[model samples]
Target: MKIHVWNAFASNNSGSYTIVGRFPSEELAAQVAAELSEVLAAHEQWFRSPTAPRSGEGSRRETPSPLRAFAQVHSLTQGESDWADQGELRAWSTGHQVFLHDPCTLSLPDSYEEFLRVRGGKVETRIRHAHADIVSLFELRGTLPKKTKAETVRALVEELHADDGPLVTLAPFNLQPAWREGSKPGEPVLTVGAVFHDRDLATGFTAVEGLARRHGLDVTVRVSEEQDSRDSLAWLRPSHPPLKRKMFDVWLLEAGYSPKEVARRLGELRHGRYVDVPGLLKALPDTVLKRLTLSRAEQAVRFLREGGANAELRPAE
Candidate 1:
């Protein structure tokens, strides 16, 4: 578990400050996120965002020379003790990322701006490089409960046999924080020891592992938790037929892809070498079946796959 803090605004031009961390495993991410809540508990006005909004505009242009947002009271809203508000501390897990956002705000910037206004003024309006309270931590905590997060991480035996997605998330916040020699500085050490639905676990996990492998980073799973999942409930019921890749993740690792590879990236489930979409665009492509929003990610991937399948029948480019 690790915590990375930046003493400035986050994306979406939200506020002028933030804390962050990335994990190869969802169980680990949940554990660290839970611990962050403990950090917030210990230090008032300190909230965590699964996804931070944009910043660096408005008066926040200048960096805070002496990072003090965490120690200083940012807003009256921060004074309000409302932990249960799905909006206040809402953690939304989508596709391959578990982001924290306030339901009350239309976007991340809304809440961030509130924090900035309450603190004093906007970041873009500032004229100097302020002290940033940023901290970044990159730690790899090996596998869990044998099959702790992975229904069968123990049975895994270096081979895939299950159909769970690459990503799964736990609301450690739903549970209490239990720390041991905090992994990041000025942050409590914590882990998600409870049980929660494995939402997008495969998706998130594999995406992470893929990046690690491509970069030659050594990693493995070691895996918790019961908590409400309304925030990411809809995702569990993906518009698609719960892609079989979840099932393939297990077998793929055994078939040859390293466990890290299985956890890090993805191809279409049915194809030994299916198309890999640019994960950055976590939306499904526009199709006749469903058109939730104007997104071309999934559509492009499909075109690539179907187009390749018929490439032999067509003339070479």
Candidate 2:
């Protein structure tokens, strides 16, 4: 029997810590377990509280809480040892080793095998050892929405099968939804790891923008200097003032600025108290001009005509 023992330290916030090692025989496995128990006991003693404060009144205090160390033992058998007394235990242990070491080994139990196949070769094996702290070991970094406990478990399985490395022990952390209004108690929170590609990041940004829009939040894409200059010149002309005002209103709405702020800024610009021509241009898309609020339709047309003329004036030279 090739037995393995893992000691996992788990915390409420930091997730889990794991110590894994292999043993050649049942006797070795027993020895390893005893060693592990001693290590944990010694660790506990190191964490024990002292009789008195070692430092001054302003000094930080270190105290031992519910945090403790625990260990798990797993055995791998080739022949008669495989015929275990308990079916689930036998199946879980066997599947765990095979899943960890051999990517090609695929004679898992029907239900779990089917689950893995459906998940596109992503499978995680979690052995419920005599100790409950060691939740599971993962070999992959899986991607899944942290919306439900079931989804989280599914993600763990996928990560274990997909990643190629030493097993990573995982226990639930502060998993909760980003938004909580519609979320139920004990509902898992969803967080996506950063996407590396620019295109993927842009797509994610767009999706988040849409969600914000749905929730009555303003979303804006900042304009470049050239665009700002061009937009401003267009707004200053007397042609499509209404359209320009409407566009400014939209810009302000997207920029997450309140109408009052827009009005105040425009007031400053008009009185020559602020050199905010570029800002004014940017604001035109979402703000209505104070003097010409009623004539927005006419103002917008004039702005469009002026913008067209400005576009033509820029020479190829």
Candidate closest to the true structure, highest TM-score: 1
Q: Model 2, 2-106: lDDT tens per residue? A: 999999997433211112223333344334344434543453444444642333344433532111212112111222111111111111111112121111111
1-317 per-residue lDDT for model 1 (tens digits): 99998798655432222212234455655554454344334323222333222243234213221112332344323321322222243332212223332213222223333443342333232111112211111222343342342332222211211222122221111221111222344331212121122332333344445533433333332221112433222322222112222211011112122322322333322222233343312332212111111122233234334433211111111
In model 1, the Cα lDDT at residue 159 comes to 21
CA lDDT of each prediction against the hidden true structure: 0.27, 0.26
Candidate 1: where are CA atoms >4 Å away? Answer: 1-35, 39-99, 102-162, 167-215, 218-317
TM-score of each: 0.21, 0.17
TM-score of 1: 0.21
Candidate 2, number of clashes: 32
